[model samples]
Target: MSGLKKVIIPEMPPLEREMIALRIANMLEEGSYVNLGIGIPTLVSNWIEGRDIILQAEIGMLKSGPLAEEGQEEQDRINASCQFICAMPGSSYFDIETSFAMIRGGRMNVAVLGALQVSAKGDLAGWNNPSRGLGKVGNIGGSMDLAVGARKVIVAMEHFTPGGEPKIMSECSYPLTAKACVDVIVTNYAVIDVTPDGLVLKEAIPGVTAEDIQKMTAAPLKVAADFKEMEL
Candidate 1:
């Protein structure tokens, strides 16, 4: 935890589709080679059009651009989710073997993934929803590999479940995709860091206090000394 000065906050809206994506996109560093997982994490490319980050798709894409404009996509250009996407000027494509090699070799700088549950200790469980019934689970795909392969893993999703339950907890009740792999968590309500001390609150959405988010999580929170409301 390095020193981060405070910033002015604007009014926050409910977590619409783009808000979550914006939060994640803002965390990217210049020249980072990042892989975005399916679901909400896929929306990140839409928000980072001008950034220098390289968007890597496990199905063999490099330097991919944002989602294609409706009806303006090339059928051959798609992402890991099989969704149409735009390619950057110097974008290139390869084979699945090459894609997984880059990931498994730890060449990716970051990975943004959606999660069903994330613990204060950084354990992730996005692959399955245990209560959904036997034989009904979400796809694991390459998330397990990307979680540990990337230099940093960031979980992006709604702050709570559809039933208004906290997604961040003291311990995950579902099957974990990876243990202690998440470095940061960006939710609609706040940005939290999984530090050795505990879940540390780094920033909060506007019009909300740090205490407001603490009550929503099952885990104990550590507010930074200079915690500020998020400007975005």
Candidate 2:
């Protein structure tokens, strides 16, 4: 948070939450076993209806569908966020033990999760937001296991905090969810890869330049050779 100035690019309007989720959904490969965390990640289910991807919920649900319509809600059919969801055909249910086992056992291929902060080295600080209180512990839920156990972790979140602070930092100020666990970050304005070298900028929204993104990012960003406008 040091030496970072608060700034906003009015010319480059950030993508809407739905568009962010849609961009993430398009990146998932076919036949992948994916988990959608709460918040923006939960909206991904709505865009993958006809895809071959299989969605898993930590609460013992498999092949979970999009959020249920107003009149189609089922009390027992809910995602990890506790939002009612539609169950796709051939959906299966299991006990909590089995559900966690699948996660900790490394059965999940990709996990789309929200983040409070991500370090340049790919450290993820998502579980506890310091604003809650000095020592209050936020519900960690299954993020720890998913961060380490999943083959790939993709964080979907806004580029900056509501107060215009950069969420991607040189070092996370909040408690870490996992160290060096993030693979990709899909923010509203850019798509970044957390590589061994550093955070690489792969894509950005039209009209936004590398210097523009650099102004908002606390960590140094390496623009990929093939950088291009995001395909929103």
| TM of each candidate vs. truth | 0.89, 0.95
Off by over 4 Å in 2: 1-4, 134-136
What RMSD, rounded to one decimal, does every model reach?
6.3, 1.5
Off by over 4 Å in 1: 1-13, 70-72, 135-138
Query: Which candidate tops lDDT?
Result: 2
Per-residue accuracy of model 1 over 128-167 as CA lDDT, tens digit each: 8877665556778999999878899989988878766788
Q: Candidates' lDDT values, in order?
A: 0.85, 0.90
* Residue 80, model 2, lDDT: 85
